[model samples]
Target: MIAVALVTGTLLFSPVLATHQVEVRGTAVLSTEEVIEAAQVPLGVPLTRLPRATISERISALAPVADVRFGQSLPHTLIITVTERTMVYQVADRGSFHWVDGEGVDFHQTAEQADGLLGVLDISNERLLRDVATVVTSLGPEVVTMTTKVTADSIDHIVLTLSDGRQINWGSAEKSAEKAAVLPTLLGMKAAWIDVSVPSHPAIK
Candidate 1:
């Protein structure tokens, strides 16, 4: 009975189990204070009683956080690890531009244009954005650096405009690996336009 009481007392009031520190990791664009504020972690609470799900839900509400992980550093600290989303594409909307990640989530808007991101023209549909993302991600680094913009009026009519005034009819996002494999060879040809939508029957003009 005495041991049971001691255990209960320790569980309820032990300073060793209280959270005294918070460590945020993997933050680049987001500040530590921002993550902490979003998490709203209950400091001084017992580490075991910390509501991890609630903390995660709060942090996940932040636009830049793609994923997050939580851990308790025994005796006094809580650790938050974050994976931020990559800004892969930019789409013009209402005179401002919005940045989208590979997951097709439009996370932020900027007044100034960002360099080195694929400019998506005439597209606002989320599904089409996802398809564009798939195509962009599938390209090799060599091809990606030469490309400037992507446009798709419909899922079946995707196009890539290169920096050097060349065009590629990339069709739908399907069979991307096959398309990517044949693109370099097509680029080597003396053509103004290359069509690899049906990679099985590539055409050059």
Candidate 2:
């Protein structure tokens, strides 16, 4: 009888301990404010109402939010978890800088520190964004950091600038997976630009 009474007491007390709490935790690749603003979830909504899948879907609408995970902390408390997309290039729209993700979505930054990012200019279309993102995503982390900007003349052809002022010519997005697979080997080469448009036969200019 005593043990059963204690167990019931714990369950009842558990709700009192963690009720009415909500936390939003996420990496702000574009900006935290954007994520919160875009979600537009109602304040004080119960954790149960904050459907995990629904919230994730809504959050994904934001270009910078690559992935999101949400859960309930207590009856009334909810926890939001998010993974932000990496900033591949900052497209100069007009005069201001807007961060573009692999999907080619534009986002506003909340801090001035983002100014030092690699500036990708002369892009006025959506097709170029996907093309650039394809190349940026294929390359490994080390190679991505070396990239400064990617300008696309056509969907298949793109030019990438490196930190050392070198240029890279990427042919077509068709063979992007194959082209990206060989990037690790190409990283060792020292040239003005490494062309991965043709993985079987690459031309260094």
**Per-prediction TM-score:** 0.86, 0.67
Rate residue 61 of model 2 by lDDT.
86
* Local lDDT at 27 for model 2: 70
lDDT of 2 by residue, 1-205 (tens): 9999998667654544343654668775545666666666665544444445765687788766777877765556566678777666676655566777777666555433364335454556777667777677777777777777676777766777778988777776677778777866776777777887778888675
Give me the displacement of residue 73 in model 1, in angstroms: 4.9
Which candidate achieves the best TM-score against the true structure? 1
Best by lDDT: 1
Tens digits of per-residue lDDT for model 1 on 118-205? 6565556888888888888899998988988888888899899999999999999999889999999999999999999999999999
Lowest lDDT 10-residue stretch of candidate 1: 115-124
Where is model 1 more than 4 Å wrong at Cα? 1-13, 72-75
CA lDDT scores, all candidates in order: 0.87, 0.67
